[model samples]
Target: MLWTHKILWIATLVSAFAFLGMTVDSLHRMSASTHADQLSAQVIEGKRVWQHYDCNDCHTILGIGAYYAPDVTKSYSQRGAPWLRKFLENPAAMYPSGRQMPNFHLSSAQIDSLVAYLGWVSRIDTNGWPPSPEGVTPAEDAQRAAGGELAGSKIYLAQGCNACHTIQGSGGTIAPDLTHVGSRRNKSWILAQINDPRRINAQSVMPSFAQLPESAKQQLVDYLDSLK
Candidate 1:
């Protein structure tokens, strides 16, 4: 009878250990899933801040939107932190010819968060939408293939520039109407202003076009010029 009691106790102990092991396994899986969800939420939140402020109106993400402004997907990698912070604080002082972005007066914390968000986006894969401009003798050839002056319009949509600058009586009203910018500014002037925007105005808010290729430059110029 004593031996029977010992066997029953041993069985109970084994069952308890098995249950504990299963519980631990389940808990680990749950924790892993939760972590994945949290990461996804972070990405979504960053995108939220972008859309909430209508960033798409001036900047282009991957290649799915308008291109009124610069392609910010690569800003984090190409631009330094100081330039990003300074520009975020005062864009108008940097580019004057066609100032757009308003003074959000964001705090340092906000700027940091925005920069973090931009950094996140800059890392996402884009399957090469804007092919490299290398090997092309004539920039115009690439421009024609990329849609010429229409390329600028496409960039405008992707960059969200239309949110501030107007074209053909459409888009936001905060900035000047660019429906006729092609006619007003010389091509060289536009190129110079875009390449190194700070040269135009120290207080200009327009973000500089850092990664725009020389070939795409001519296409954008042609597009802007065609606007007239």
Candidate 2:
């Protein structure tokens, strides 16, 4: 019985040591590849800005924070720097939707830092989390190729449609996915909704775009119609 007990203790010690060694090695490897290891001065400052502004109050980073806004882990990649800059500069104008984001009135320097920080976050390997597939349909691509000129695409971003509508698997979840809006609604109906969503749905929270120029409205409608 004494010998059996000794053998059992030896086995337990061996297993514990193996587990400890593996754990230490894994931690060491992860630490070497951590975001901190690649952070630049600008990115670090941008992180500070993010915290200073308490953006986490509304948005989430790396699966942390309130669900009031969309996850920003890959926002830099999803929304290009130009669009991000415009949105940050004037959230109200960009969204104009019912749930409009308040403008921070951030200066150019602050905007640069925030964008830089987000860019850094976008590069991190998140193990394929928050799956955001490029939802561009083939028809949409063909339309874009045939003299679409991206005018509508720009207008869509400028109007902050993504704030309430999901396109290509990104943006807020409050509204329906618009990846194939053209297939769901006719162009005239879409135009009507844009002009005044309340006219279509009495309970809709979408704000009116009646102030937009006639040509701009047409361009936006055309762009949306291209989404198959």
Candidate 3:
């Protein structure tokens, strides 16, 4: 009975020491601020909005949350503020692919705050957590540098095409995979569809790109055409 008690005490002490060591290591690692002084008043408000909306329910930030949606940790870096604002304003219009991101119908002020919060979140060092930019290709980079197709690629990103469409194994799967759309559709048909998707398919949900600059539209067409 005495030996048994001694064994139990030793086991409890070992567990306690292990737990303490882990806690101390975690604290030491966290000594440097992940967010630091980047959180401003606007950022704080934005975070409040994010929490109030429970965005973490659908999207993961800093590797925390449900895996149903994309990680938003580096959204500011990937999409930029303009695209983010537009997306926040009308998520359905941005990507009619199929994964429905309900429109929150946020006010301009709320949108600003949300973007600010995301911007701040983007500044945190996660030690290369996400690891790479999504949907980007070496060929696309080369085309972009050459200035025609790349310009269209920029327009695609600016317009938030990835929200609905997947490209080269990246982006959402709500809509048709556009990895090789160029091979399936000609430039004229693609342009016509972008200008008025309803002309081709009565049930198409794609919004018109007629408002975009002609150059941007043409560049986008060229980019899509080059996808083959």
Candidate 4:
């Protein structure tokens, strides 16, 4: 009985030590993985802003919070600063249809701070979490290679145009709907818009995507021009 008790005590100690060691190792690595040293003062304020409005109640970040809205963990990287700024400024204008994020009427400073904070959050190493559950392929780099998806459509998706423009009843509504844009605008006009939106409309809030490869620009233009 005494020896059995001693064995149990030794096993418990070993297991406890193993758990403690692993916890310590994880904590040590977390700082590097999350880039904690980059947590700037603006970022902290952004976090405060996020909490001040209870954004978690409607959206999820880092896979924590309600699932009612889209996960914003990677939204910063996916949407880009310009798009985010536009959307944050007017959530209703961005998504006129479907579930709408209320117009918080947040001040410009607040919006900038929140954007900066989200930027930091997006940089954290999440080890490829929040996988695309609706997609056919699990591989990140696997571009609909086997599917019959259009090359132009693929380019549009890759460029994140859906962040502002609605196409075929899908995508964001912040910008003009492209469901029938082909019928309204010519190919040259579409190309110009892609290269520099401000050229067409001085008041256009849309950012220029002139940096995209020439081939990609043509492909994207083809996709947008075919939305008839």
Of the candidates shown, which would achieve the greatest lDDT relative to the real structure? 3
Give one digit per residue, the lDDT tens place, for model 2 in 1-228.
699999999999999999999999978776554566768888888999899999999999988999898789878877668667767877765565566677888888899999999998888777788875468776877877576637777677756687789889887677789899989988899899988889967987676676667887888898889889
Listed per model in order, the count of residue pairs whose N, CA or C atoms clash below 3 Å is: 36, 0, 4, 1
Given candidate 4, what's the lDDT at residue 91? Answer: 80
Per-residue lDDT of 183 in model 4: 87
Off by over 4 Å in 2: 1-27, 31-37, 132-228
Q: What overall lDDT goes with each candidate model?
A: 0.69, 0.81, 0.83, 0.81
Candidate 1 similarity to native, TM-score: 0.41
Best-performing candidate as measured by TM-score? 4
Model 1 residue 171 CA deviation in Å: 26
Tell me the lDDT of candidate 2: 0.81
For model 4, where is the 10-residue window of minimal lDDT? 140-149
User: Compared with the true structure, what per-residue lDDT tens digits does model 1 show for residues 170-228?
Assistant: 88776678898978998888888777767978765567665666776677777777777
Off by over 4 Å in 4: 1-17, 132-184, 191-219, 226-228
Q: List where candidate 3 sits over 4 angstroms from the true fold.
A: 1-33, 133-159, 162-222, 225-228
TM-score for each candidate, following the candidate numbering:
0.41, 0.54, 0.62, 0.68
Cα displacement (angstroms), candidate 1, residue 210, comes to: 18
Instruction: Note each model's CA RMSD in angstroms.
Output: 12.6, 8.4, 5.8, 5.4
RMSD over all Cα atoms, model 4: 5.4
